[model samples]
Target: MTQDKLIRRVLKPVVWVLCLGPLGGLAWLAYSGGLTANPIEFLNRYLGEWALKFVIFALAITPLRGLTGWAGLTRFRRLLGLFAFFYVVLHLSSYVGLDQYFDWNAIWLDITKRTYITVGMVAAVILLALAVTSTKGMIKRIGGKNWNRLHKLVYLAAAAGCLHFFMMRKGVQLEPLMYGGAVLLLLGYRLVGYLKKRRRKSRLAVA
Candidate 1:
């Protein structure tokens, strides 16, 4: 098969299944009563961590494609981003419906009073906006330049997500720090690429 056919027929389906694996595992755990003593907390944290992981994976796609010269990677970017948003929604739903039992008053209080929760909510909102405008129709309607500018908010969303995970943990934790470091590295890569592009443009303009 051609590379394009291989990606479309084999790789995409494999990735799709892998992305759903976490949720499947979670479901199995719930059914088997393997969520330990605090099922609600376990479910919330599990889904939230997967959401962050997907976000990082989505962000990594650009850098990876640039470095490897595999443009086909771009085809999966939107799919990964949508899965990130899917997991984020599942995370929030678990918190609201399972953990908080849909107590709007209490949920509002938590959002207002809890710093980590506030940060998480901000990240969720940004992801939602990106997901909503991810379509080709939205891109055409908004214009490519404007769409690019709006989508840059993904960096901020990823940063806030890292911060939220860091703050949610008690005291200091290695996992959150590692995730935060990964995000920093990805952001640094993008910044360096942006600077290089600007420098090249400036030299061209001068020439």
Candidate 2:
């Protein structure tokens, strides 16, 4: 099959299933009494990790496509980004719906008092903006330049998310450090690209 057809017909569907698989497993665990004493905590952490993972994955797509010469990979970015948003929303839901039991007052206090929650909320809000504006209509309405400017916040959001995760954990966790490293790598790639582009422009202007 053609690359376009493969991306659209096969890869996309497979990715969709893989993305949803976590939630499905979580549900099954809860139903089967597999989650430990604190199911809410498990759900919250699991969903948040997956959300952050997808966000980082989305961030990595550009560099991957450029390196691998797979421009068609761009088609999957929106879906991946939206999945990041999906899992983030569910993460928040698990916190508020299951843990907080819809306690708005408590939730507000926690968000205000807890540094991790504050950062997590900020990241979530940023993801929400990105997700809402992911559509073609929204992109056109906002215009490409402004839309791109707004979407640049994804890096900040992902960085904040890594910080949030690290802060949430107690101490000496390799996982958060690895995530931080990954984010730096992806952002570093962009930085390199930007510098190269600027250099090229400078040479052209000089000529």
Q: Pick the candidate with the highest TM-score.
A: 1
Task: State in Å the error of residue 34, model 1.
Answer: 3.1
Q: Write the per-residue lDDT of candidate 2 for residues 58-134, one digit (tens) a residue.
A: 99999999999978888989999999999999999899999999999999999999999999999999999999999
lDDT of each: 0.96, 0.94
Which segments of model 2 are wrong by more than 4 Å? 31-33
Instruction: Estimate candidate 2's alpha-carbon lDDT, on a 0 to 1 scale.
Output: 0.94
Cα error of candidate 1 at position 7, Å: 2.5
Candidate 1 per-residue lDDT, tens place, 30-128, comes to 899999999889999999999999999999999999899999999999999999999999999999999999999999999999999999999999999
Best of the candidates, lDDT: 1
Look at candidate 2 and give me any clashing residue pairs: none
Per-residue lDDT of 60 in model 2: 90
List the candidates' TM-scores in order: 0.94, 0.94
